[model samples]
Target: MIANKSLSRLMAHVTPGRLLSLGFVLVALTGAQAQETAAPPPLAGGSQDEIKQFCTNIADAARDQRYLLQKQDLDKLQTEVNDRITVLEKRKTEYEDWLKKRNDFMKQAEAGLVDIYKTMKADSAAPQLQETNPILAAAIIMKLPAKQSGLIMAEMDPKKAGVIAAIMASAADPLTSKDPS
Candidate 1:
């Protein structure tokens, strides 16, 4: 049989305010229990292994993309370097060809000058010498025979002859010069 005294004591403590608070506590505990027993909807990504594999694939793809970009940059740089080298090589070849042509032209001009002067009359040579610069006239006169050079100089104006003579003297071999040293 129930103890009426203990039951009466318990009933006395269950006031309206205490009853509402007890109801709230019971509701909170049941709500937690319900949530614990329930299953959440499955994710669209499927199993944990699949999601892990997908993440691994994404990481691998990013790494491969970076590598490919670096490779492309290197290839572009290499192409630029190769193009520059080709241009420089072409320029070097052109310069060598130009130098060779210049040397050939100089030889031809020297030969032509010698042939013309050798065939030219002293009178004709004199007028040409007077028209040319003193330095060039001196060089041409120096290449002629002593008799021919004298005839050419005699035909030149006295002032022009003096200038040409001075240029020739200055260009003479040091050992053969009028200078004592």
Candidate 2:
């Protein structure tokens, strides 16, 4: 009760907009904490293969995301966002067809990740990769086609692009330090 009184007093001094913002932050933090604390569902005793299949399906879905992005025009920038969504639909259809024909869904998923990596390397090297800012440079490095890294670097400010490019190039290496965040 005393704690509540202090908190209410503190909140009272905050502007209405600030109070609402704090409320939103508090809600988000509490929700995330609850999710982290929630117990996992009990696993079925004999569903190992089924679990593998489920994971395979999810990875395959992820591959379609990359494929669809690849087909969309990145040069048009703003207009291409709409086209990318359409490409994603096409990729989904292709993934579904593959899943039906081949029982080895897991292999397909692994191959898709490799394909995405190659695509990113190529796109980032492309001469036309968007050179808007360090943030966009980082974003493009993830989805750019293989061989476009050089192009992104050429278009960007030397210092900022160089640092990000080095990070991109070394991502294949094992992590040397834990993520601070």
Which is the leading candidate under lDDT? 1
In model 1, the worst 10-residue window by lDDT is 172-181
lDDT of 1 by residue, 1-181 (tens): 3799888988899999998999999999999989877968576746878989989999999999999999999999999999999999999999989988987986687677756887888888888889887877787788778888898899888999999998888787586656422
**What is model 2's C-alpha RMSD?**
36.5
TM-score of each: 0.39, 0.23
Clashes of 2: 19
What number of clashing residue pairs does each candidate have, in the order they appear?
0, 19
- What TM-score quantifies how close candidate 1 is to the native fold? 0.39
Best by TM-score: 1
lDDT against the true structure, per candidate, is: 0.85, 0.65
Model 1 residue 125 CA deviation in Å: 1.4
